[model samples]
Target chain A: MSSSSSGNVGIVIVSHSSKIAEGAADMVRQMVGNAVPLAWTGGDTDGGLGTNVAGILEAIEAAWSTAGVAILVDLGGAETNSEMAVEMLAEDRRARVVVCNAPVVEGAVIAATESSGGSSLAAVKRSAEEFYA
Target chain B: MHNVNASRAANAFAPLTASAVLVNAVGLHARPSVKLTQCAKGFAAKIEFALAPDGPWTDAKSPVKVMRVKAPQGATLHFRVAGPDGKAALAAVLALVHDGFGEA
Candidate 1:
């Protein structure tokens, strides 16, 4: 990883469909380039319309950084699974990860932009949540 | 390049203002809105955008808010920027719009 991308909050997109997760990740990439670490996970292990806790955990790790990680979910299941994934993290890592309550796609894009600008994890989460406010 | 009309406020605390036409084919769609907000965040100014001269202004630094503006092609984008870097913020935003967000 380049030094510029370090310290920026990471982002994870969680959705019931893999396509939606990937699509939101694509938008974040297009807008922020490689300025922030980003990852996405969706669908069950069976490749159906559901979210997986293990997969979400892996995504959180893939996009992990010391600055922190913000997860955006598509629906209730995605959110529940995301919370479980966070719970599975090591105690220290758990504190740095949060499942935000915001629209999946829009929240991911806005969160990634805030992350790219070197905002704190809380600030990024607040920016994404602004959509719902 | 699009024409930009910039003016300073009579009150020192008042925000600097500018207007520029969205010349890009898709106007302030997803991509352009992201670019605008990203550009706006680079400065220390508190920037707002409105479709009208006196609006219903939206925070220019929030991607979601800016995207919600949905300013269409040829629509005028009015900006009100306040802060220490207000002048620079207004100039950068106007330049981005005039450049059609590099999509023209």
Candidate 2:
């Protein structure tokens, strides 16, 4: 509903704790300040330390943009669920989603900044991957 | 703030050098590093940062490399700038560095 988050590359954060996912998103919002679209799903739909495929899918949908969406997960399980969400998307949407290989907090922040600059899918993912460097 | 590698104009006369002391309690950690990297990307120049004035400069435009420095508080980061908009890029990095990244 905000102009700041519209028309930019989007980001989805997946974490085992709603606090973490939301916190990471908030931190990014602080740094980038709504310059990029951001969405997140934490824990299970039941509010446990698990990821929900449907929730992940919905989060991705919330952050969707033609510029592309980058997903960052807190752990392996979150990663798996995120992948499933991508698979569950319509073929057209699936093509625009990428699960990044960066840590959740750092990756989300880095990716959001890159997205705010209106970068492409590959470039945002590349910046996230550079977390290890 | 010492100059390790002397500035040489990559073109006719636009090379620049700047320095800033890391003042945050943890040095150049996640938030600060990310802020610096984002600032570095705004220019087309070839900019680098290093702990030493004379050796081992890393690309300013790379978040990974900037994070790799693990520059702690009290460490002074020196910058080398060359190419188009090099002077402007150097000034921005130096200012951001001095800003302490809004950290304690």
RMSD in order of candidates = 5.0, 4.3
- For A1-133, candidate 1 gives per-residue lDDT tens digits of 1338779999999999999999999989987678899999989999999999999999998999999999999888999889999988999999999989889998998898888777899999999998989
- Give the docking tier of candidate 2: acceptable
Model 2 chain B is weakest, by summed lDDT over 10 consecutive residues, at B1-10
Off by over 4 Å in 2: A1-7, B1-14
Write down the C-alpha DockQ for each prediction: 0.49, 0.34
User: What are the TM-scores, per candidate, against the unseen true structure?
Assistant: 0.88, 0.83
lDDT (Cα, tens digit) per residue for candidate 1, span B80-99: 88777889889999999999
Tell me the lDDT of model 1 at B34: 78
- Index of the highest-TM-score prediction: 1
